[model samples]
Target: MSEVQKYTIADVASRNGRGGAPVWLIYKDSVYDVTSYIPEHPGGDVILEEAGKDCTKAFDDVDHSSDAVTVLKKYKIGEIVEEEKKYDANGKKKKRVVAAAPENSGNRSCMNKITCGLLG
Candidate 1:
């Protein structure tokens, strides 16, 4: 496969369908050029509302079907730059790691009670 194109937020924002430019938006840090798909969109002009912006939350709020998602993939032109990416290499959202509590102070008895409470 060809090397995927990389775009910065400014690059995506510039193609906002104004003055004959392409329409683009970001979802999960991946960029898409949806100008050609605009007319066929089931949501009509509603899709335009997200032009040149990150629309992941709005897209998920509607709970798009698998077919819709598959279609969306066809228009993917590239991805947001690495510094701006919210997902890992596998396309999973990077999980926020909570630091484990320090064990030095907690009594063994307390931990045992908590463990038993969970298992019991």
Candidate 2:
């Protein structure tokens, strides 16, 4: 059986008003930055009002299509890490442990490599 990962959504909500780190809406391994879109959300204020808070319940209640899910995957926050067996120079597999860049760092490789080319 696959294990389920847990997040303290309620804890995040409680800290939101106190200016905590922006809470990301993660689904199917993709993280969405819903902070900027809170005020403009079509679902009304209450649903998105807790931008920096935990809104997993609210988000789960929404009606989104599979296509939307596919689109959301494109906004994935962190790089998908894969396990390697050996190191190579051309493929350059190293034992160095590289940490994922923090969210809200304004660095999105997908944006430049994927989004820009498709949108523009």
Candidate 3:
């Protein structure tokens, strides 16, 4: 099989709404070109705010439906490079930091979670 394309964060950032290049963004380490879909986005121009940057948190915050995620597949472009990904001193991708919940709240969602690796 042919190799999948891999892009650096900088490579994707440079194409944001400039010239005629498509607006690309990263989500969960996967890169997508959403230029054409911008106008069709249900959330409207708000999506543009995340152009050229990692939109993982913003995307998850909205709790988008599975259908919305399926739609994103059509725009799939590539994956981010390893060196371009944020990593801890031990060389793993930085875990997402979430705030701790109140005591006795029965909530322990603040623990660190491993994100997709570079190839993923």
Candidate 4:
């Protein structure tokens, strides 16, 4: 089977502009969102230049583990995206992420199914 293609930071930035998609740059499996951290980037414009582009080399140069760059899932990034949605909101129409219920809330999956079934 063919490997699934992953996106570079540059590709994401170019696709939507500065903040575009809050993408997780997966080098090996662990995910990192360099979006919110862009301005504070130590590499300055070079890092920004690498924005939307793969920063594997940059990451390596900085000593980030290669194995920590995989398992990127868009759904796992509710926090940063929501924080970004708060200030400097962009895009034609904004999509909001629903926060996961707290731990004390019981049977989340069942509750979700029931709620969805009701809604449907």
Top lDDT model: 1
Tens-digit per-residue lDDT, 1-120, candidate 4:
654444433344463225455534433222355565545545554545444434445666767443433322332232223323222333233446789867765555777989999999
- Per-residue C-alpha lDDT of model 1 across residues 1-120, encoded as one tens digit per residue: 799899999998888888998899999888998999988998897877888898898999999999988999999989998887888877678877789977775566776889999999
lDDT of 2 by residue, 56-82 (tens): 345557766676566555544431122
| TM-score: model 4 vs. ground truth | 0.31
Better of 1 and 3 by lDDT: 1
Q: Roughly what TM-score does model 3 have, to 2 decimal places?
A: 0.68
lDDT for each residue of candidate 3 in 1-120, tens digit (9 for 90 to 100): 877799998888887776776789888778899999999999887877888988888988999999999999899898888666665545345877789856765533334222333234
Instruction: Show model 4 residue runs off by greater than 4 Å.
Output: 1-24, 29-31, 64-120
Clashing pairs in 2: none
Q: What's the count of clashing pairs in each model shown?
A: 0, 0, 0, 15
| Model 2 regions lying over 4 Å from their true place | 1-20, 47-60, 66-75, 79-120
For model 1, the superposed segments whose C-alpha errors exceed 4 Å read: 95-120
Model 2 worst lDDT window (10 residues)? 78-87
Candidate 2, residue 105: Cα displacement in angstroms equals: 54
